[model samples]
Target: MGWIAVLVMVSVAIALIAFRVLRRKGRDDGDHGASSVDFSANLALAVYLLVLAYAAVLCRDGLSVSEADVQAEAESLTEMYWSVAPIPEAMPVRSQIRQYTAQSIDLDWPLMAGREMSPIPGQTLADMRATVLGLRPVGEESKNLQQDTLDRISEVSHARIVRSDDASTGLESTFVILMIISGLLVIALPWTLGVRPTRSSIIADLVRVGVVVIGVCFIILISHPFSGLGAVEPDAFKAAQRQYDQIDGRFPAQP
Candidate 1:
């Protein structure tokens, strides 16, 4: 499961704990000490909100960096495609490159998003190398194209390596602990302030609950997009595929 799902489960556990505490307090105090609870709850809620805001910013920056890496890989693939056109017998080689690029984007993207390794990244790399070796020519232009293709391959390979490293890192335990603490603090805050129990007080309690629920939901939604943080760009992948098809059409495979 993704970290978001795990975090959601943690939040639910916090909610249950809060509910039990509130229920017990209600039974013993009979709404006589609502004012005291309210003050404490408000204070806790304020602190939790501040911490959550900071966490959200950090998550956003991390996701942006991840996305940039994917884009870089896409650009490298594009350059590789352009460079391959000058090589002798480029059609078959172009087709192979296109397929590899597409697989990286379409298949590998989903796998990385789930923090899993693709089953065939190695096989794909081997196939690409074979294709590069098959395009034989002795001219300087051909040599340059070969070097460019190698460079592009290296870039994409490095991107995948980085993503693999990231997958293992997972969420920091400290962050998860802080999130749990924040949820608990939010629930406890209202009771500690000794707020009086009245119709208005009950309404205010409901409002606080609503605010916490909304905040949690928003966090979940924002985090959802990051689940695909290390995936390749679909648009750029498609462009490479198109270029591959064009080259294949022009050069037709040998009998």
Candidate 2:
């Protein structure tokens, strides 16, 4: 994603020089054509920036929600692990919890790039619920603990749904198209004005092109929260691994 800006700038520079070489006789550098083009071009630039800003805000909010979802799920997993610890029949459930976390961090997280997720963690969670359901509690306290465990499982499931939504979220293609068209218009309008393209004017146009490239690339990078630069990582799950270690007092990574 970072390379996108660099590539755009290089390509624009080459194209600009080529167009300059093929230039014909220019019209008089009069005030009328320059002012009209300049005004329209400025408006184009402003519209382009506003669209990028809106897209950026959308992506940023998605990223924040994704991070929060991950944190919530990890915390739920940790709580569920502790909830199942006291039930003798639920020992296997602890292992299942660990497996789900492992699959989520290692398998599901990567698949989020394609707006997909692995079924392994989901299946593991279902199995854990079944295991807890089959448990027989003795006292009211044990029943309460069992209910707490089930509630944590539900919380984790809800968090997963939110995370999945975030993974699929991104800027709309229409916005991308609009941004590209407007940005190109900004770069090309001055040329269409027939004002003489002097060395200084050409240099200024190149700088404008650079700004457009940067804006376009920045928006593309921020289009999604699950991939590319500044993506929402599985750091929360990594922390959950440590939490599990503390909960189990040294449980291994795998079942």
RMSD each, Å: 4.3, 3.3
Task: Give the Å error, residue 174, model 2.
Answer: 2.4
Candidate 2 stretches with Cα past 4 Å from truth are: 1-14, 25-28, 250-255
For all candidates in order, the CA lDDT equals: 0.63, 0.82
Q: For candidate 2, lDDT tens digit of each residue in 66-166?
A: 78888999999988888877666676888888899999988998999888889888888898889889889888877888999999999999899888888
lDDT, candidate 1, equals 0.63
Query: Could you tell me the lDDT of residue 233 within candidate 1?
Result: 40
TM-scores for the candidates? 0.74, 0.88
For candidate 2, the lDDT comes to 0.82
Write model 1 residue lDDT over 71-131, tens digit each, in one string.
Answer: 6766777677777766656666666666777677667767655667675765786677777
Evaluate model 1: give its TM-score. 0.74
Candidate 1, residue 177: lDDT: 56
Worst 10 residues of 1 by lDDT: 224-233
